[model samples]
Target: MNDVSMPYETHGRTGQKSRTRTALVTAAREMVANGQTPTVDRAASAASVSRATAYRYFPNHASLLAAAHPETGTQSLLGDDPPDDPAARLDIVIRAFTTLIVETETQQRTMLRLSLEAQDAAPDHAPLPLRQGRAIGWITEALEPLRGQLTDEGLHRLVLAIRSATGIEALVWLTDMAGLSRDEAVDLMRGSARALLASALPV
Candidate 1:
């Protein structure tokens, strides 16, 4: 019995559909990595899939771009054996997060451009996945040890500050504007995360 409510990929010929979806997403990511914002049709062409099939997976440009975003579905930045100390945990998470940002800078930049364009096109448009604050969840999880010591608001503020210092936006300014090397930018971001956490701790 086919469940009509299921997603297209899960409905029929699941293996082949899943492969088609992965190919589309892979093509889109490759395009994004090369500094191109890809449409579903373009991604389909790149992936050697038909336009009709691509549209079945991604209904629009926004949906395709969102699916291509490097950080779209990430749920956590910490490792399986993350330390209990909030500072150590934060350091681990921030380092991993910044590394991902640097390695995927091209994709990040494309998404950032799209996000800005979307904002300019519609003042009230919902933010793209790039600006949707997934890092906040990761940072908050890394700093969860401080939840008891600090109020929820305080912890949230700390998370926001760290996120502000350690993401792609900060990376772009540090590298392009401040003329820092990628390594320097990452180090500074990690230091800023630690400093923010230290400030929130008792002296």
Candidate 2:
């Protein structure tokens, strides 16, 4: 008896389809980076594949957008450890987030655009502040030790301050608006984050 479980035709077609999908996704990402709004047909053409192939991989615009936006579904920069020393942990978290923002500048900008569009299209859509609050919550946890020193209101203010001081908006302003290089922007952000943390959560 022959093993009929493995459908050779389907298996071969699936492998080909997977490669084509990867190509289309890559093409879409490049197109987005180049300031083009990639459609299924456009992405397929860019990838040198068929529109049907692109549709097979990305059923809709949302799927393509999700793929093109790499920052989506990423874990917190702070990682697993919620440090016992709140102040130290805050510094670490801020540093990590700043580093990410600086490194993935284009992706950060794209995220900001997507967020604004989402909010405009649907007022109930999750706000960027709420999305950022996850990181801020980690920062707040890190500042737990200093909770006694600072009031709840003060802590909240400090969290907003730190986030504003080190976020991609600042980075964009410095880099694009102010014409600073990526290295210069990152260094500025690092300095600002450190200064804010030091002043707000003094050891």
Clashes of each: 0, 1
Q: After superposing candidate 2, which stretches have Cα over 4 Å from the reference?
A: 1-69, 79-83, 117-134
Best by lDDT: 1
- Cα RMSD of all models vs. native, in order, equals 3.4, 7.9
TM-score of 1: 0.92
Worst 10 residues of 2 by lDDT: 1-10
Query: What TM-score, computed on C-alpha atoms, does each candidate reach?
Result: 0.92, 0.60
Task: Give a tens-digit lDDT track for model 1, residues 1-203.
Answer: 11121277767698888778778888999998998878888999999999988888887887777777888767788878889999988988898899999888888998889888887888886766446677898999998988789999999989998888988899999999999999999999999999999998865
lDDT of 1 at 21: 79
Residue pairs in collision within model 1: none
Candidate 1 overall Cα lDDT vs. reference?
0.84
